[model samples]
Target: MNFSGLLTLQKERVPLKSIEVELEVRDHVATVVSTLNYENKKNKPLEAVFVFPLPGDAAVCHFSAKIGQTQIVAEVKEKQKAHEEYDDALSSGQQAFLLEESDQSPDIFSLSVGSLPPGESASIRLEYVTELAVQADDGLRFCLPAVLNPPFNPQYKYRGRKCKSFEVVYVPASWLSYSLSFSARVSSPRPISKVESNCSLDPLQYLNTDQTQATVKLAAGHKFDRDVELLIYYKDAHQPTAVVEGGQASAEPGTLMGDPMVMVSLYPEFPETVMSSGTSCGEFVFLMDRSGSMDCAISKSEQEETRMSSARDAVLLLLKNLPMGCYFNIYSFGSSYEHIFPKSVEYSQETMEEALKKVNQMEADLGGSGMLEPLKHIYNQPCIPNHLRQLFVFTDGEVWDTKDVIDLVKKNSDSHRCFSFGIGEGTSSAPINGMAKEGGGHAQFITRSDRMQAKVMQLLRFALHPTVTVTWDLPKEVSVTVLSPPIAILFKGQRSLIYAQLTGQSSEAAEGCVTVKYSLAGHPSENQLHFSLRPAEDTGLTVHRLGARSLFRSLEREEREHKEHEDGGVKEKLVQLSVQSGVSSSFTAFIPVNKDNGDTIQGHFLRRNIPKPCEFTGRNFKW
Candidate 1:
């Protein structure tokens, strides 16, 4: 995953689609945007940031690594005592922030460094191991401390996921081409447990050296309450963490620019079509929460908009995308049940537009959150023959208490499937994804307005699938090593359906026997997972899901892994892609976000924006 690309641009600032960084070892990675700091002790700080785009307008803010304090280790004792606040060693020189848990980005993290003493200089290089732990869906953000004024100022970009390490190596004018390469050296024989089991993954490497490592130890920890310090591991604790980015700057500095960012498109490693029951008789019920929180948005100002507005936009889009001959109903929850369609309407050309209007009619009630009651009422109803009931639930992913709704979904799991769409800045995809996984459906979110339509259409397509029970059997071993084994079904379902990716094995076995069992119509149908290493076959890799080169990458890895086998033909392709799209293939790899921005460096999610349009609707829900 070691990668280095040149970026030379003369612009003040630009919005990047993505960026990625790579390294040879599994060390944490750090990125910086180097610009001249003129004033002495100006407190000119910068931060990196990003977000996971959820379907239905839900967004989560996160930070990957953390800086506990900015106290510096000055070589001069007089200066250290004079700037005691900035020189405090307790949290000051203790500035190397590390990652706490494993996550995919557009989740946010920042690296903040203050102005140096006049004539003094410092450089930072992020480090992480190049292991299978890093995967697609992780991301990075580079942000400077913010000012109260317009601040689309100078910055850097990252591609999909960053490599092991990528940095803007700081150098003094005294030396030309005297840049330091961000490199890592990782070697260990045993596993190190940094994070606990499901709550989080362990650290990439153990802290054997004092200068290079900082550790956060927790005996009994609360997911949201636990805080640690480190650029890589500190911020990964509670899904996403927010930090103050870009400090108070009195004046704008000259911009430091780079080439346009580039992004690698990602596709689901699952079946493109929905598993159906043969005939298309389905009913969809959208349960939207128009409570107080829904009125929130990620505001540039303090009076941020609520989740309600975005939820309405997303639902209207869903209403417009309902398939023909489908029966659907839309409802809103606050203290009472407000039905948009009045009665369960049989979907058609005539009714779809009306439903859209109804969805648009919704506005935030500003009432407190109350969703359990609505779910309870919906679940108590009896079954409907020849109809697939899908509940598309929208909320800020919060209700204070959700067990009641979960119980209701559990009660109705046999006849109905619930697809959860989360919305808002505080919205958590984990709940919706959990609901979907429990009730045989999927979850998604919408982080911004522009992504609303595509996110909605993707959900509709996911619901429109012709079958259910999209299962595969791949010799268990072939299925074990997949880092994020996208269960060839999540392509059209919700959530990721990956199992595991096995390496150092057989190629034909990597392309082993896969039987897909699905029930679509009155006929109850199924398809076999027939994939091959041969490039010529239309394994649907290149044909179904937009037919993009990025989506169908397994073939290249398969071919390589087949050639490298000593058994003797297991090529590098299988194991190689574990860092690309395959399960466990994620590492800190760099990708360019836009054609104009420089190379981006974050974790993976920058490339795999959460709630990606047209991906699997069925996300795995294991909180």
Candidate 2:
């Protein structure tokens, strides 16, 4: 049966109309409040399931809704318990809201608004805080995800489903009912230099004469066709800065959010030669995905180039730019993998020409997007001597078992560094980022307006150079810890972020100093960063929340690696943190109950998920 046949529709109406985003940036952390205005125009009370996207690292702090004159606040509970409660509420004619993260992809979330009376409107507000990632150009980058790229879904033999390809038709931004209104107030320790965006924006409004605070907003007329990206620059952006935040008063002491936290940012000043001279020789392996879904367009506009074509162009560029006397090879994978050569060959004019001709002839004829086997094949090969091994992956990132791939890369990290390229919009960030993080490399995203050449070249430069490894030495009374794993590689223009808890109290008169050491170009280097023990004016505990997020992620990684699922209170601790900090995690969910007494609308209520335009095809698909 077709996808629509799987769903029973009793009443139908538009679920989403407009989105309003309000963001606050203090130093390097950003807290965003997004309000989604939804209307139920159906004749009967109905439930609406809306699937949306958010940044993978976002720590969701709040979820609430307003219907009529009543406001409903959501509570954090175990995922299964929340689901059962939602079902009971809906059966008893009570309005309910359930928000959950997708099991397969952390970036995708689903929201269910149940028992909405006809002719009524529900306004949803979600608040989250996340650490801002520094870009390669010394600018802070923020992306408001708009396009929900369709992933490749395959049928298994047990399911007995057809193996036909699903198409997603692209729709222009003009088709959306309302535009997005986004505004942000930014405050930093350094002076603000400039703000840039992929979309139109109003002029910056400085809040003070020192130029440390500014406010900016998106222009009135904007086409929400693609992801909205902003690059904010500050004067002397590379300088290291430290922030100390007080813990929440309501929280218990000695807990994750109960104690004062310190956030340290270090941008290593490596010698210029360390990054420039290592380009002479290396083993470069390119893995490209040519699954059938790759045939679709990357942008909402059908006029944009297909993902397969873009991959071809990107590979061609890299092939021509490879350093002479280096080992290089290309492998294309779908259901199976095929290499242009049996083994890596020297980069020469003849090899480049042969690769280009084969690349041009490549098509999206691969049946499935399974990449594990191909990756295993690539890893099984022996590394060439006297050459640094760098593995570059280009794909739309639609694999089912993302953690498996990350685990494989992690196991082989000592042999080679990995650079992952997520092609097209709606790509899964979990895999792209996980591979790079575990493989000791960096991840890059390529969208319609993004220059593939610039991003590819950036990764090439990183591969050819050696990155410094950083370590911090703290005082005996004070211990430093990272929420994530220790630093493996430190690339130029990249920020080294550390979040730690200050357990023992230090006198206000006492000063705290940290010694950071790293080896650059086979030589040792050290730097000192000192800050006052006294707490600054209490910011909203942004650092505590971010640090907690990091700690939770680290535990998750451990659990995944060990397959303990939640051994040693790892699962329990994660839930407790989510409940106390108001952050959503894999084990917790947000469920809200509306106590408003309306007609007990109960019976087989139909379900409808707003369909998103697919990048591969312009046709719409519902999952």
Among all candidates shown, the one with the greatest lDDT:
2
Model 1: worst 10 consecutive residues (lDDT sum): 255-264
- Model 2: runs farther than 4 Å from truth? 1-13, 148-175, 269-271, 300-302, 448-450, 464-477, 564-568, 593-623
Model 1, residue 324: C-alpha shift (Å) = 4.6
Q: What TM-scores do the predictions have?
A: 0.41, 0.86
> Per-residue alpha-carbon lDDT of model 1 for 51-131, expressed as tens digits?
112211111111222122222221111111222223222233222221111132211222223223333323222322111
Specify the poorest-scoring 10-residue window by lDDT in model 2: 1-10
Candidate 2, residue 72: how far the Cα is off, in Å: 2.4
Quality of model 2 by C-alpha lDDT: 0.71
RMSD of 2: 5.4
Q: Give the candidate number with the greatest TM-score.
A: 2
Error of 2 at 614 (Å): 12
